[model samples]
Target: MRVTVIGAGAVGGALAALLDRAGHEVSVTARGDHAVALTESGLTLDGGFGAHRAGVAVVARVPADTRLVIVATKANDTAAALAGVDVPSGCPVMVLQNGLGGDELVRSVLPGSPVGVGLALFAASLVGPGRVTVTAAAPLVIGGDARSVAVALPVLRAALPERVDVSADIRGAQWTKLVINQVNALPAITGLSVQQTVADDRLRRVLGAAMAETVAVGAALGVSWQAIGPVDAAALRPLQAPGAEGVAAGEELARMLARGMGDVPNPASMLQSIRRGRVTEVDQINGAVAAAGRAAGVATPVSDAIIALVHEVERTAAFVTPADAATRVSTTQD
Candidate 1:
């Protein structure tokens, strides 16, 4: 497969490198120092996917006869990145990005090209100028035209540890991921590491409130969420083992989460974004939920507050470090 990956940052570099190693002709569209580095040193992918360097054609221009174009840029950069890129009319373009509206944006850019959206459950980052770090290994849930899967799936899975699942109801899956991802912004805002944020009872309560608001909004908008207590409990299920058993255990854990008993850690993506001084996708995450709430006539005060705090941080151009977390919390409270 001839694949071109735009945005040679964390996600793009990681995917492009792995696909290149898999015998696919991979090209990464990056700029400036990153492009130069990728051309010279290849891409260093570390962490769960292991440490390896794979050679890929790094170029500024999109190549002709490209089989697939994967857009892994940030949500804000999607429009600018795809502008003027020449893809075949029927060629598949996969959007591997966070938040909603990414597929629509890609469709608008490519017009006749088949556009698919992927919600990546794993965590990855550009730790250096030419290196990508995979913090967690999770599946990439993709929903789009079936024809697009040919190149997208093989290339993506080759790079990732888990296989990609083509979804029938991608929107539902995206919303499910979004509801869970509401906690990601916590690490950025509170200046806490992944484990530290989830360990705090107060932070977990805050996140639980936000998740409840998103679930409510989803319900109001006619999004049917599966009964997600026991069936969905796999990794977090064993956390509360011992005396409880089977369905009873699942129900009990579900009850605890619903009532804000269990704690959860922040996601690495949001933390990395804030730490690197890049804008957080709070507007597209929690802000999207709040917008849905309004359209569905559901009130989402918790989400609204979360969005507001994140927005303020963005507007002020400030970085919330771990040492300043207490001061920020105190100021926001009063």
Candidate 2:
């Protein structure tokens, strides 16, 4: 299969390497120094799966004979990344991004193409130009039109790891990922790895509050939540209701997150963005939840405070302590 990855960031680069290793013809579109580096040195992937260097075709323009197009650009860059690229009619385009609305955005771009939505649960980060580190590996869920899934499955299976699955309810899966992503801003604001952030009891309560608010908003919007990996969205409903039982359920949810994470010091994408001096995706992740909550008349004070703190840190280029985040979370009124 001939694949074209639209972004050479973490997920894009990692998938490109995996595909190339799987013996597919892979080309990646990148910009600035990253493009130059990929062209000169190829792609280097390191960490848990060992090291691999693949000489993938690095191009600024989308290649013509590409069998599949993978949109791996950041949520905010999705529009600009695909603006000029011409995708063939009826070709399958898979959007591998965080947060929501990525599939619809891709559909808007290539109306003739089948847009498949993917929720990538793994952790990969761009540690250097033309290099990415895979900290964790998890299943990639592809869902949408049946024809599109048929087109994307073989190519993705060939290029990606063995944990890829197709779903009929992709939107529900996406909402599930979004609810999980609400915890991402906490790590970014506090400058801690995801595991460490979730391990702290105070921070875990904050995460619970944010997640509970997200689940509420999602419910109000008529969105059904599906379980992503081991985190059961149905089990989390108890956290949304007010009571001592709900508090206990929230604590259990936090513990579940901690256990799922183990001791891996993997940083969330938003934290990685701050470390790279790039604008974090708090707006699309936690901020999206808060926005939906407002429209649905559900309060999202926890998520709102986290968004504010993350943006402030982004502006000042300073690290926020976990203690500071706890203080803000405590004072935030639901």
- Say which candidate scores most in TM-score: 2
Candidate 1 residue-wise lDDT, 1-334, digit = tens: 7889988777777777777767888888887777788889888887767778888888666788788888998877787787766666778989887777888988877788888877776666777778987766556777777767666777777766677777777777777777657657767676665556555655554555555556667767877442222223242334233222322333333344333412333245666666667777787788889788899998767676666666666667564544344344434534
Q: Kindly list the per-residue Cα lDDT of model 2 for residues 1-334, writing each as its tens digit.
A: 7888999799888889988888889988888878888999999998755688989887766777888888999887889898777776777888998887777888988989888887887788888888899888777888887777887787778766647887668888888888778668888888888788778877787887777777778889988777788766667688778744565566677677667665667788988889888898888888788888899998888778888999998999897887878888779863
Residue pairs with backbone overlap in model 1? 198-264
Q: How well does each candidate superpose onto the true structure, as a TM-score?
A: 0.82, 0.94
Q: Distance (Å) between predicted and true CA of 187, model 1?
A: 1.5
Off by over 4 Å in 2: 243-248
- Judging by lDDT against the true structure, name the best candidate: 2
- At residue 331, candidate 1 shows an lDDT of 46
